[model samples]
Target: MTETFDLSALKQSLDAAPDHKNLKPLGLQTIYLGRDALTVLPDVVAAMVDATPALGPVAVLSDSTPKRYHAGDLLSFVTGCIDARHRVRNVTVGVAGHTVHADEETLAKAIRDCDGAACLVAVGSGTVSDIGKAVAAAQGIGYIIVQTANSVNGYADDRSVLLINGVKRTIPTRWADVLIVDTDVLVKAPVEMNVSGFADLIATFTAPADWYLATLLGMDDSYSPTVVGLARNQGSALLEAAPLVPQADPNALEQVAKTLTLSGISMGIAGTTAPCSGMEHAVSHLLEMATTKAGNETALHGAQVGVTTIVAALLWQRVLGEIADGGLSRVRVPGPAESQAAVLAAFHTVDPSGAMGAECWRDYERKLARWAHASERIELAKRDWPTHEGTLRHLLATPQSLVAALQSAGAPLRFADLEPSVNEADARWAVANCHLMRERFSIADMANFLGIWDDDLVDELIADAAALGSSR
Candidate 1:
C-alpha cells in the first residue's frame, strides 16, 4: 500500500510560506486519503456530530445517481456508516438520469433540504460536493467531502463552479472540513472519469503563465510562485503516471489524486482560481453554456478543459511569437461600449435573454477598467518583455507535451473526441470569445489587446493544435 499523504506537513509548510502571509485561513481541516479511507467516515462523522451537538442531524448529501462502491452502492455504504452512530439525513439532490448542476435552483433546493444539519457529508463526485459546500456555507455548518472519483480538484478547495445567469462562475463556497479519497473507491470509478482528472490537471502547464502575465500587466495583484509550485513541481510525476491511470493502477490514481488536492489548495491559498484556470477554462465554460442552452448533454468539465489547455498553450506560443516580432508596439484597447457590445453579441446566441451577457459584462468590465488605467504597467511590461517572456516560457509547457500526457492517459485529444462531441463551429465560437466571458486576464486577453485575436488568429491556433493531434 502507498503511504498516506501527510496533510499536517503540507499545512505547516504553507502556513510558514512567505508568499501566503495575508491570505485567508485554510478552512480544510483534514484530509484522509488512500486505500480504505472511507472506513474513517464513521468516526469522523461521530466526532463532528458530537462537537456540534447544538446543530441537528448529520446530512449525508448526494445525488440520486447510483455509484459503485466496493461491491455495493456507494451512497448506501456511506449513509450506513454515518447512520450507525449519528442521525443521518439522506439529502439527495438531482434526479437519477439527469446531471446535477451547481446552479441557483439546485443549490436553493439543496440548502433547504440540508437545514438544521450538524455537519454535511457530501458523498459523491464534483457536482454533489459543490452543492454540499454551498449549502454548508449558507447554513454556517461544517462540510465534509467524501470524494468518489479522482475527478476535478475542486473537491479540496473553498470554491464551487456554479452557474450565475447561465454562465459558469467559480463562486466562493466554504471548504470541506475533511476530504476523504479512497483508492478503492477511485479505482472502481469509470476510467474516463479518472482520465478526465488527468486532463484537468494539464492546465497547470499553461495557467500559471496566465496568472503571472496578469500580474505583469497589472490586471491582477496575486501571483505566488510558491503557491503555483505546490502542484507544478509534480508535473513530471503527473506526466509519468498518465498512462497508468487508464489501467486503474492504484499508485497512479493516488499520485494524481494527491497532486490534484495540492492543486486545489494552491488555488485556495492564492485566493483565486487563476493559478489553475486560465484561457482553457473560459473556453470550456462557453462550450458548457452552449450545450446547456441547446438542451444537449455536456461533456465532463475536466475533459473539455484538458483539450482546451492544448489550445491555450498554442495561443501562448502565438502571442509570444508575435511579441518577439514586435507585436506589442501595436497594442490597442477598445472602449467600454465597444467591448460591452462584443460581449453581448458573442453571448446572444447562447442566451437570448441577455442575462448571461450582462452577468459576464459585469465581471469583464472590471478587467477593462484595469486595462484602461494600466498604461504605465503595460509600458513597463513592454520594456521588460524579454525577461517577462522568459519567465512565461518557464511557466508554460509545450503544446506537444500537454498533448502527449493527454494521449498517454487515453484522454480526449480534440474537442470532437469529447463525449457528445463539441462541433467545430461551436468550438471556434467558444475560442473566439473566451476572453469576453470572464474577468480573468489571460493570454487570450493579451492577444485581444494586441489586436491579434480574431477569427484568423483562432483558426491559426486551431491549425497549430491540429499539428499536435489536438483540435476541434
Candidate 2:
C-alpha cells in the first residue's frame, strides 16, 4: 500500500516558507489521496452541508455518459453516498448528445439546475470539473471534486478552461474545498486517460523555461522560483512513476496524482498558468480549435500537449542555436498593424466569424505594445544572452528524453498517434502559428523576433521530431 498524502502537513510546510507569505493563501482545505479515498465522500459531504445549513441540497454534477465504478456506475455511487444523509439534487451537463464544453451555455444550464444547492460534487474528468468549479462560483456554494481519472491537473486549481468566443481561455474560478483522488477508481479508468495524465506533466520540463524567458524579455514579471520549485522539484520521481502508470501501479499513480496536485497549486499560488503552460499548450489549443471547428473529434488535451512538448523542446533548442550564432543582435519586433493582419489571417481558417481572431489580437496587441517599447530590455538580454541561455537550457528537457519518457509510458509520441489523429496540414499550422494565438512570450516568440521561425525552420523542427519518433 502507498502512503497517504498529508495535505495539511504539506500546506504547513509551504506556509512556513519565507517566500510564500506574500502570496494569496490557498483556499483548498483538504485533499484525500489514497487507495480508498472515495469511501470518505459521504462523511465529507455531511460535514460541508452541516456548515452551510442555510443552503439547499447537495448538487452532484456530471455528464450523460456512464462511468464504471467497482460494480456500479460512478455517478450513482456518488449520489447514493451523499443522498443517504442529505437531500441530493442531480445536476447533469452535456445533455445535447455531444461532448461537454465549459462554455457560457453549459454554465448557465448548470447554474439553473444546481440552484440553491448547499455544495457541489463534481463526478467526472477535467471538463466536468471545470464546469463544476464555475458553477460553484456562480452559485456561491462549497465544492468537492471526486477525481475519476488522473487525466489533467485542472481539477486541483482555481481556474477553468472555458470557451470564450470559440477560443480556449483559462478563467479564474473556485477551488474545490475537498479533493478525493481514489486510486482504486483511477486504476480502473481507461489506460489511455491515466497515461494522458502522465503525459500532461511533461510540461514542467519545458514551460518554466518559457516562463523564465518571458521574465528575461520583460514581457511578464510574474516569474517565481519558489512556485516553479513546487512542481519542478519532483521531476525525477515523476519520470520514474511514468512507466508504472501503464501497469496500473497504485503507488505510482498516487505519486503522479500528488505531483499533479502540486502543479495545480503552483499555478494557483502564482496566479497564472504560465509556470506550467507555454508554447506546447498554445500549440495544443490551436490544434483543438481547428479540429473543434471542423466538427471532428478532438484528441485528449493532455495527449496533444504531450506530443507538442517534443516540438516545443525542439523550438527551444533552435532558438538557443540562433542566439549562439549571433542572431540575438538582429532582433526585430513586428509592428502592431502587421501582427494584427497575421493574427487575423491565421485564425480566419478556424473561425470565419472574425470573433476568434479579434480575441487573439486583443491579447497579442498587448504583447506587441510591450515589445515596441522594450529596446532597452532587448539590448540588455542581448548582452546577457550567455547567462539567460544557460538558465533556459537547465530548465528544458531534450526532445530525445521527452520522447523516451512518453514511450516508456506507452503514451502517444506523435500527433498522428493521437486518437482522431491530427493531419500534417493542421499540425504544421498549429506549430507555426502557436505564438500568434496568445500573448505569452515563448521560445517561439523569441525565434520569431530573431527571424529564425519561418516556414523552413518550422518544417525542419517537425522533421527533427519525426527523427525522434515524436512527430506527425
Candidate 3:
C-alpha cells in the first residue's frame, strides 16, 4: 500500500524534533493549503492579530507583474479576501527586465519604504517571498507568504539568496509566520513554472549524497539522516506526479507544492541548506552570475537546477564507478595559496576587474581551511570507500532517470531548453568553475580536490547529459 502524505501531521512531528526545540522558536505557525486557501486569509490575519496584540498595518509586498487566475488578477483576488477593518498597504517592488532579484539594496529600500508595517504579505514567487522575509527580519515585523507560484523552494526556507556586491550569497533570514497556498492560483500558473518546481524537487535525488559526503568528512556536524529520510520518503511520489504537472492537474500541483515545502522544512530543521542544495545548486548559481554579467535573461532557478542535477548525478555515477572498480588513489590536496591562485585564474575570465574573483576567493578560502582541518576524516572516507560506495549509489538517481522525469514534467533537460539558452561552452564553464563560486563542500569540490574534475571529465559529463537528453 502506498502511504499518503499528510503535511499537517508531518509538520507536527517536525515541530517536536529535538533540533526544532533547540533552535529559536520561529517558523511557519500556520499553513493553509487547498483550493479555497485564499478564502481563509481573513481568518489567518485575524489569528495573527490576536497572537501579536500590538500588530500594526499590514504591508503586502509584491512585484509589478500581474499574476492572474480565471476569476481575475491575483492582487485584487487577494485584496478581496482581507477584512475591511484591517489596515492594508500594497507596495510593488518594481520589476526590471525578465526577472526581479532579491538584492540587498532592493530589500533595504523595501524595509525603508514599508516602515512601521506590523506584518508583510509576500505575494509572488520565490524572489518576492525572499525579499519580504529579509525585510520583515530587518524590521522585526511578522511575515506571511501568499504563494503565487510553486516556482522555487525558497518560499518556505529561512535563508534568502541575495546579491551582495554583485555576487550571489545565501544569508540567514526568518521563516514565514503563516503560509497560504491556493491551488486555484497555483494551477493557473504557467506550465513552465510548475515544472520548474518539480525539477527543483528532483535535486533530492542527488543533494542528499553531497550532504552525506560532507558528513563523512566531518565538515558539517548538523547533518541529519532524519531530515533526509523525510525528504526521501516523498521523492518517488513527486517524480510520479511529474507528468501531470504540465497539465496543471490540481492534485499534482498540490503534491509538488507540498514536496517543495517539505524540502524547505528539512533545511529549516537542519539549520543549513545542505539537505536540499549541493553542487547542482552551485552550478545554477554560477550560471545565474554569468547570465547576469552578460546582461541576458536568466532561466528560472529550479529550471537551471533541474538541468544541473543531471550533471551532478552523472559526476557521482562516474566517481562511484571508479571507486567500485578499486580506482582509489592518494593525491595531494591543494593548499590555500595554490587553491587561491586557481580560484583567481578560473574567475578572472568571468570578471576582468577581479572583483568577482576576489569575492569568490573570500568564500572559497574558508572551505579550504575546513578541508585542511578535516584531513583525518577525508582519509577515513578514502579508506572506507568500499563501505560507502553502496550508500552513494543508492542515494543518487541516474542521469537518464532524471532526464526522463524532466521531459515528462515539461521541464528543460539541457542547456538548450533554457531561455536565452546556455551553450555548450557556458555549461562546461559552469561545471568546471562552480566549486570556486561557493564555500559549501560538494561533489564538485570533492572531484576538484581529487584531481578528477578536469576539462576532459567535464566534457565527458556534458556529452553524457546530451546523450541522455537526446535519447529521450
**lDDT per residue (tens digit) for residues 1-472 in model 2:** 2335566776787788777764556778888898878889999998998888656889999888777777778888999998789899998888555667777788889999998899999999899999999999998898999998888988888999988888888989988999898888888888888899889989989999999988887888888888888867677898888889999898888888988988888888778898889999999989988887777778989989999999999988878888899886888989888899999999998899999999999889989889777788778888878888888888899998999998988889887889978898999999999999888888899899888888998888877877787331
How far off is model 1, as Cα RMSD?
1.6
When sorted by lDDT, best at the front, the candidate numbers are 1, 2, 3
Structural similarity to truth (TM-score) of each candidate: 0.97, 0.96, 0.94
Q: Identify the superior model by lDDT, candidate 2 or candidate 3.
A: 2
lDDT, candidate 3, equals 0.81
* Candidate 3 TM-score, C-alpha based: 0.94
Query: Candidate 3: worst 10 consecutive residues by lDDT?
Result: 1-10
Local accuracy of candidate 1 as per-residue lDDT tens digits, 6-69: 7678778878888767565677888888988888888888888788755588898888778888
lDDT of 2 at 255: 83
Off by over 4 Å in 2: 1-3, 16-18, 95-97, 470-472
Clashing pairs in 1: none
Per-candidate count of clashing residue pairs (backbone under 3 Å) = 0, 0, 0
Q: Which is the better candidate, 1 or 3, if ranked by lDDT?
A: 1
Q: Cα lDDT for residue 19, model 2?
A: 74
lDDT of 3 at 406: 90
RMSD to true structure for each model, in Å: 1.6, 1.8, 2.8
